[model samples]
Target chain A: DAGITQSPRHKVTETGTPVTLRCHQTENHRYMYWYRQDPGHGLRLIHYSYGVKDTDKGEVSDGYSVSRSKTEDFLLTLESATSSQTSVYFCAISEPGQGPPEQYFGPGTRLTVT
Target chain B: SQKIEQNSEALNIQEGKTATLTCNYTNYSPAYLQWYRQDPGRGPVFLLLIRENEKEKRKERLKVTFDTTLKQSLFHITASQPADSATYLCALDLSRDDKIIFGKGTRLHILP
Candidate 1:
């Protein structure tokens, strides 16, 4: 319970369509991350933000993009949704110099691409 | 390339016994290792974090041990209960970057 919330907890879209998921947090954490979890692949980081207007790609950033215009929000976008991109996306937040430096996750958003 | 691996098979254990899960990595040294527990249809919850300098850490019935020399970490749950059954994930923070890498996770089942 990181005081985080993700919009559209469940979604369905068609291939080639664009989609965006929103993650909001009330913790005022400095670090926010987006990860997708799929069977056999585990959870792969798509992107992360260190601060407002500061972001970086992760291991699997090929078809995805992220933005953080405010400290309390991080958005993940699929420029062109594909069936292969279907996964349960999770949002996590961590505060620098915090107790254990471990990330706290939100509920998650399940996306299905047809 | 850096890689992290964990037992993919579900681990079955008897209630009241200790269940141990292993996480191994290669080609990377992490500043710390973290463990998370995930239930079905939910996001992972943070469990424990062990630094390179610390050999072990404990919280109640859960214990985590990190061995940088071996590039491995072990997570243990003592006096296991059916409620403790879930997928356990091990993660490592990149030494040179702010990113973190996670293992595939191991499913644990505590049977009565």
Candidate 2:
């Protein structure tokens, strides 16, 4: 309900294929994050962008890349999709410098690699 | 590595009763803790945040208690209703940064 949207709610792709997931926000937040959720592992951060063209790797950054060219759009790309990469991906945003600012998440995208 | 934990068992209680959930941490001391409610097929919604300096926080029917000494936090919902059934997750802000770590979460159900 925070004016955040994710594209391709569900997708199925073959192994070794490249896939890109998009996240757009109308709130103009400075912080954008990409996370993957799996059974028993909960959610783990993949990458985050603090400002336009300023991106950083997270706890789990292998095989994943992200870009923030504009203020509203943050893109996550899987260089080579694999069956292990199949999981629910979520995009989140937060306003920096706020008092322990809380992140607002998008509905999420489910990806399956065969 | 810092870790956060919550009881995995689903908490069951009668409607109009108070429901309590616990979150514990290890190897890392946090300055603040957060609670979030997640429903099936949806992202989590922020519920409450408590600072280490503060002992407790209350918002309407929801209350949270933070004890740094014990490295645990308690979430309570008074006058619980059937609509409150969902999985509740707790998060902690890591030292010196705003990065957050989350728990697996505990599912809650309110019986009518």
Candidate 3:
């Protein structure tokens, strides 16, 4: 398994509340990504970071924000939680220039917004 | 917009038989396609990757075939076992954007 870990492995928050999830990696990979998985929708990219302080939005970046101040940590924050946002969040890491760039994912964080 | 489609239904295969899964896409052909496996509660783990130019690639009991003309990819697991039961996902690179899109995944059950 990759040396990646997500904090607050499980979280339950009420609607309109602030929620934040953290992803930490020891691999020092240059690329880090946040993804959300739901039934029937599969996995959707939320945000990604290529290097320190460099980030970009993904296909489903609405209502979500991410910050990568350091190479080892990436954070995802939901300003106000919604029931539709309830899903399993996964953090993945990849090292570019290392061939095909296969991503290694963490255990994932299951978030429930009611 | 690019779309990837995989059978949403679960597939049942007997142990020691071969299991094949299909992934079809619409839009431009990707330079690289990847496969991953996920258990019920865990994140996906990378399995195999095949490039558009390559017709087939193999690793251990797994094989991946890419057909650019058909805009599809096939994943096969031979000599299947009960332990192989899980959801398999297929992902493809979106041109040279450095980002890949994933399919909904197909669940496979290896009945013993």
Best by TM-score: 3
Window of ten residues with lowest summed lDDT in model 2 chain B: B93-102
TM-score per model (chain B): 0.96, 0.96, 0.97
Q: Rank the candidates by lDDT, best first.
A: 3, 1, 2
| Model 2: share of real contacts kept | 0.44
Q: What share of the true interface contacts does each candidate keep?
A: 0.82, 0.44, 0.76
Query: Which segments of candidate 2 are over 4 A away from where they belong?
Result: none
TM-scores of all candidate predictions against the true structure: 0.97, 0.97, 0.98
Candidates by TM-score, descending order: 3, 1, 2
Q: How close is candidate 1 to the true structure, as a TM-score?
A: 0.97
Model 1, range B15-64, lDDT digits (tens) per residue?
99999999999999888999999999999999998999999999999999
lDDT of 3 by residue, A1-114 (tens): 599999999999999999999999999999999999999899999999999999999999999999999999999999999999999999999996888889999999999999
The candidate maximizing DockQ is: 3
Error of 2 at B10 (Å): 1.9
State the lDDT of candidate 2 residue by residue for B1-112, as single tens digits.
Answer: 8988897557998999999999999998787899989898888888898988999999999999999999999999999999999999898886646568789888999999
Q: Candidate 2 chain A: minimum summed lDDT over ten consecutive residues — where?
A: A94-103
lDDT of 1 at A58: 90
